[model samples]
Target chain A: MRFGNKDLARYPFLREALSYVTKNEFKIEDLDNSEFYHLVEKAKRKIEDYVFEGKLAYQIDYNKTHEIIVQEEVIIFLISLLLIKSISIDSVTKKFALFESMRFERYLISDLDNSNQDDKTVKLILYKIFEDLFQTKVDLEVDIFNFYKIKISDYLDHPIAFQEREWNLVNRTVDKGYVYLDGSEIVRLFRNELYLLIIDRIKKMNPEVLPDMIISISDSLKSRWEKMYPPLRAPGHQDILPPCIQHIYNQIDKGENLSHPARVLLGTFLIYTNKSMEEMIDLFKRLPDYNEQITRYQLEHLAGKRGNTKQYFVPSCEKIKLNNLCFETVVCKGISNPTQLIYRKSSK
Target chain B: MTSPTTSSHTSSSSDKLKDSITDSFNYPHSVEDDPNKIWLEKVFRKHYFNSSSEIELDNYVSEHEFGFRLFDGYIRRHLNFKNKRELIASIIKFSPSDIFCSPARYQHPSASMDQKGWIGADLIFDIDGKDLQLDCARIHNMTFCKNCKLIEKEVHTSCSKCNSSMVQIVELPCQNCIRNLKKEVTKLVEVLHDDFGIENNSINIFFSGNNGFHIHVVDESFFNLSSMKRSSLTQYLLGRGYLVDNLGFRIDKSDNITMLPNKIYYNKGWRARLLSRLHLQLKNHRIDDKFMRKITQIKETNKIGISGVINNQIQNISVKIDPNVTIDIHRIFRLAGTINSKSGLVKSRVNNLTTFDPFKESCIREDALVKLDAFVDTKLFFNGTSYKIKTGINNIPEFVAVYIISKGIGDIYIEKLK
Candidate 1:
């Protein structure tokens, strides 16, 4: 690990502590001070208490709290991305890991913003804070810990209720209020390549397995999202999609029913852009055959284009509108799902 | 320890020193003679701890268990962050064994470096009065570090005076390390550029303000890349390799092929490339007045697909909204960052929310939701050690709404269902 100017000046105590540990693993008795020894002792005691409490109840090996702590640490660690600048898309997934932890921090801190600002304002703040941090425009005042509280709540109370497979995520978050992931765990959580592979595998599976396969796939995707952005309560009155889906939503037309596939598409887009709307739109347009006729039609449709009832060869062309402006809509009928359609939109 | 009764109430009190900084008696006090914990805890409690009411006692106890890890990049050379080495040399006089530790998050992948970045150190520090007790409890239950990371090894150098261990390291390179590790940094930058079709001008580097360097490529082209492509860039830079298999458009010998089993496709590669082009076009294409013409043209092209080719260009099914559809102008503007929320609806909401009602602001609904309600309702998750938005009985939404609402594109209202 490297030391920055700030870390060098403010944390000499940390450096000294690190020096002793990596060298010879010392015992509590090795150090001369009792206060420092007591601190460690206390932590071990509480952990033991949790373990004992669980054991007495015939629960799992370690208290779920231990894993929650580990998870919380990872979340804070992810926030360190703020210390670094020039954040790129590759770093975006890792960035979400920080946001995930911040959600947990909020729960720990207790007090969060209680403004009447639109739900989007809250959503925007979450997104903006990350943007500010990545761009080095951080508000030293913006506490990442409190931020996680609202986020975790949002996940738990996600507007779309949890299903059977989401039980693990629900248990981890609802029961412990934290989700654990190490460096590898974080990587695995955000590794979109794996999801793509799973989708590919499902494509090869026989039709009989398709339903279960899709359910399993949705479960895995949801689980990953819960780990990445676990919530404590479902989405509240704010009609805006969760940060996970806002940018990915083709359009936020009123009464648009959100399907799992649509959410996944939105999630994938959000993950790719670090949840930046501008970045997401950019990624959407860059798919291999994204500019082909079929792709254009879909993109136009998402942009709010409506179909031209009079068109013969094209049957009915779609029309989309931005602001008050009305534009022709391009449609892709073959792909029933938004996620696959997004893929089709890009695959020429 | 001296008993509180024996000491001059003001003699060695840290609270007295802090009092001079703030006249208000808002500082948090503990049972200890040493007021450092009290003061730090006071500041932390005010800024971070008070952000939520829903937090369970167990949760609060846990946050205190683990003192947040600090990676502010403010350490001096001739120190290590591994255990208590850095602490003893610079700040605290303690051993690493005294504190419980965990791995840091968002660590730069070694792919960003030529060599494995130096092994770092971790420590517990008191910010806003956090101490061994609260920090220890936090460590016991909380998994996340509000502010913590592994110290880069190369960032710090050995002390000339004592030859003591120094360990704040740089991931990309320190000025000193750069002289030694320029080749690696350059290699990474080149790889990032080549793979993403990004240009050299798009690449920029910055010091992490600590022991590492951050590399950014700002090309819009890269933005058009999908998650898989972006992941590949990360993997490539981190040397993680590529996705051997995934459902996407693969360019085979300059031809496009869609491997999505049940879908029909004409020119797959071309479509993928077009998608990239449109993505760039949208990113650069603003919604300002000047860009409106092009926007209209796009809409037209999208309408009655100009050719069988254009018809095939659009990929996803088109979703249409009612031409009369109107969203809350305030909400939309808030998201867009164009409208100043101060003068409009928020002002009245603020007034109504706060109990100080001398202004008699009428815009605030007695039942209107205020910022504090919003925080408690939605943004409670990120409220850590700082940035607290409190909601008490006095300030209601109707009070503040009088100060802020203005006619915008439209006002988007999210009702709080009691």
Candidate 2:
């Protein structure tokens, strides 16, 4: 399954697209030059749209032949990555990754849904991605539920945040090491991989490499980002956290090893108090054994950010006692749940 | 023969070893021991010296964390040996009550658990006879309540007098229960082989030196399975957590579940297993034509439907392995060829399940005559040989004496003779 120049523009994250860009010798100097002025504007617009709307901003126009910029898309994506890296803010980088992967997810699904058995290229690309790229074995007979059989190892490594019993490996019909999933679900899995791939290129860059066009675009992005996005940690509510939760929070703050149940208590407590994804990631990164991969999987699962989409509630005082996690204080006497502790403390 | 003085003082002495590196203590002297434990130690010492070849240590032996439980109930852990001879030497030196080794390979085998860089571990499923809940256990097992001090067959959940469930069950599981445990192991092997695609040769089963068995999947593919994946494997074998919705069943708009009976494929996964179970139920005439008609005809009623039959099938599910043992990757399993403290029998490897008798084959010590004070009326039945030994002084085989003494059902008769 070979990709054409138009397909390359659509999936610049693919190895073939990167090779095409490298083979054409797309240079960094072209971003600041008149010869690639078409791409420079598009790259800046990509970063600007990412910081503000968290959306990808490019589309192909096959009908309008004069406006076709198929050859410049990969170069624009690379320059956009350079601009993001020059910005060097972690939150902005994460936002860029999330948007790009989501956009890819949207595009990939539309492409697959539009294609049929006669479209030999889609079937070939399915094998090319599963067999060649991810090395995942696949049998693509879309069943009654639009599900296809995939290998268990590949299924286990799926990057999508799913906590539903339906998503559980045991709950699915696993036959001879194969799990079932739909095309959209499969795209969701690789979309996360594409996210991490983009993130790797976005971390820790020399703002020294910023061109005039990139610098102007980044300045606008930074100002807009500072105005729009809230700080990862919201002020207040820390003191009002239940004693049991506070104990765990303090333990993590000091880079101590809290037990699994204790971490769950603290995680659910923070998530329950309207702490966003970035805030939770910020809070958990302070732990001694914090592995970003593991923490993200668990935190997203608890937040119900993915499958089943059922958010976890903080354990009540009675339930907390069953796990032996309760540290009752005189101020917490009447409160039955941890979420109530905020009002309990503020009332005093 | 051990001196009468040493045998008498076995349970009296305190631990005298101060050093941690050596981890050795005088067997008949300062380290307090049980008489049954001392006898078992003597048997193990001879067995390791003679039958060390049979005790196969897991590969990369230097990277395995070995541990030993002493007669005084002290566990010496985080020990490593370079070769098989060194392990045997330690076994012969310590005369430990039981032997154990980690299934995991570590960078620093002697380091603390967190410090031990765990590379991988074999997937093991432990099937203890007590967990099987076989009816035969009531005939041979005994339960002693902590509060009321009542001793009887293991048929009570709560003490009649104290009403407290603070009871300890002493299980000398008979041949019947052991046979049931073997059947469970067979089921587990089949499930691992067929459903999970684990080869039969890659799966090794060991009698747990007691009334149980341990299955180890030694294949390289499974060595690096995470705790989550291992947990799923356990669930699959036990027939729990299956999604009937994925297999052509759905809750109807009117509330009752609607299932496509025509779509039930009798060739793959849970559908195949469930249909086979239904076939058995049909053969027994328990599931009549009316019930079959009711199942295929159910659409939109408030009445409870096919869920009852499915729930019944799930209840009488497949494998009966202890889930905790499989899920925990860091667990130290009993090393094969080591004597189990529960019954003074070796954890021997089994070849033929039909003829393998734990009481007979796992008995490594010479069958010498020994007198014992039997504590209860217990039956020792295997291979058409049955002994319904009653309370008070009785003569029995040395192997039988060690078992009965270790199980807390009998005592060595030397003290009574004196």
Candidate 3:
């Protein structure tokens, strides 16, 4: 059941790379000696050509990195390194290795700036494919939670629960609306050490051949690989709203009578964004039987403009659910409140 | 209470008080002459100056405001030093009644006025014994009404004599008060370690000489937390101004029944705490006799009814912390190993909090003897020994004398036995 020659049949690229590296005795005396580096460079060149050639039949103008192909190469490279015993995994190292791999998978699908719906869909599909192809055999998902001694149900249902554990394991920044899972610093350094050794030998052999952009790109990719999960904002800015907020917005647009919490959430969200009073009044007019005076008073009250002068915070995720208005989508996972979503959206 | 003293004794006592005040106003000549000064010098040299030979002052004490409370009761504030040796030398020279360092980090800790650019500070929690709600029998505690100039024998929020709200509460630390303080300390440690995920080594716990405990979290990650973030954390611990309605619990309007969601059990923070407590009450017979009987009669079948019972007890479970201390980053804390002017004992660190008896452990002046002129009949306990005093000069251990004098019940004079 182990991942070895048997699994290599399904993954031919891994088999070929393993044979080539093993035949060379896996001695990385120079960059040219490393077939893995050549494969990465080739993959990078292919992505760059695909982006520059205008071959993609998409309307998005940004340069599209063929992340799935890059991910497949990365997986194969890592598997070959594992096979050759280049990247050793002890009990402690195994936990971080799994965490890093999961992070990589998560990062690949993470919507980069300017990514459209089609790009996201492709990245998700590729991430799933990569997960099925390698992550399962490695048992990364189970091992990550097991390392923390937390049940998967507890971790998913309450992501903040991880914050109660060790800081080296998980970092929860509720205000930032994200939880960062830390990979082992030792494993990360080891990977970078090996990568730098290859790059160093490459420069020593041919100093003028390496393009400046290529070197910079390689350095950026290396740093990205080292950081398990850096802070990131949601893509598409405010245009991409959480499903619940979008649902409420649509309801208000159609003059539907929203529930009390929904109205409060909408009003608070608008006020938080510094919407004008007139604009808020106009928006509230969408509600059925919405009297201008009552709406103005309520808005003014929530904004702390009324007599009591108490500014109200937006309803949390649980509040939305308690008010029977929660209609969550997959992206809403690990977010606790509507304000967090707005914060993330605005951070973009 | 004895009969009021004669006018002759009162006038003589007043004249003596004036002479003693005038004499105390003169600063000590040298460390050799004063026992308190000698003790401070020896402790500072042994613990701080000698032991910290290799450590640079910039590492721990840099950019921190140094304050000294001299024996004359005048506080020299906003003082700074260039090096640890200089700071230690100044502390030994002054032999201050109390030493304090600002909790806040600053660019120039010594700079006065507009020059001291403020930075961030360590997240600190101060659990004072005076603030704890201890239901113990009152002793020789006293309070003064500022508005009516009436003194009371017991601590009160308002003056009973004049019905004025401007009454000051003077707290005398007792066994019950210290025990209550320990409970708060334990709760704070749990919240910090279990709830906030701060490591044991990262947290530093200290006994504030007279009446409280101070917790300092030196973890670098929290160094940059804004005041707003700290306020949030304080509110979270105090369980005040929290939105408990957002916990996804709903009530059925028709039957007036409450339902607990299955997901709430897995939710973290206060919601998870609520669920677990409820589950414990149901599993064990820890509920009230009436509720236990009702649950037993129902055979644990009605979760809605049980949840309703648990919901009423939510506020009682949350830990109480001093919100102001946590929120104010610029607040100063008593320097460790320095004598508290009130208690005349060093504010020392507790290595193991569970077995720490503050009264015995903080008793530093055990060898010295002191004569205290008691003004009221009071019973005092120290180090498992009890002393009953009746309005006269009583010779006792220096520690007990300091305890009595700190409570404002008596005046103490150190007497060297030849």
The TM-score leader among the candidates is 2
Q: How far does residue A58 in candidate 3 sit from its true spot (Å)?
A: 14
lDDT of 2 by residue, A57-148 (tens): 65654553321444566677777788777666666676677677777777778778998755766666666666655677777755434456
Question: Fnat of candidate 3, please?
Answer: 0.00
Candidate 3 regions with alpha-carbon error over 4 angstroms: A1-348, B1-59, B112-120, B137-140, B145-152, B156-167, B241-248, B251-269, B280-314, B413-418
Question: What is the lDDT ranking, best to worst?
Answer: 2, 3, 1
Scored by lDDT, the top model is: 2
Candidate 3, residues A1-348: lDDT per residue as tens digits?
A: 223232232233333424634564543333343435554454444322222221221111123243333334433443323321221212112222222333333333332223443443433333333244323111122232211122211222331232222221122211111222222321232233333332232223433343343455555543442352222222233565767777876665433456567788888877877889997775665454356788899999999999679898877888888666788987787899766766776687
TM-score of chain A of each: 0.18, 0.67, 0.32
| Candidate number with the higher DockQ (2 or 3) | 2
Better of 1 and 3 by lDDT: 3
Please provide, for model 1 over B1-418, each residue's C-alpha lDDT reduced to its tens digit, 9 standing for 90 to 100: 0001111223442322211212112222332553322322332233222222311121111111111111111111111133232222322221110111111111221111222132221110010111111222222221211123222211224433344454222112112332322333454454344323345655554221212222334444332333222322232233221121111223232232323332212111222233343432322212233333443354456544222322243322111111111110000001000111222111111111113221232111233343322212111111011122232222324323212121111122334589
Please tell me which predicted candidate would have the highest DockQ against the true structure: 2
lDDT of 3 by residue, B43-119 (tens): 43343343333222237576887666565444555677666777787765666656677767789876653567778
Q: TM-score for the first chain of model 2? A: 0.67
Worst 10 residues of 2 chain A by lDDT: A61-70
- Spell out the clash pairs found in candidate 3: none
For model 2 chain B, the run of ten residues with the poorest summed lDDT: B1-10
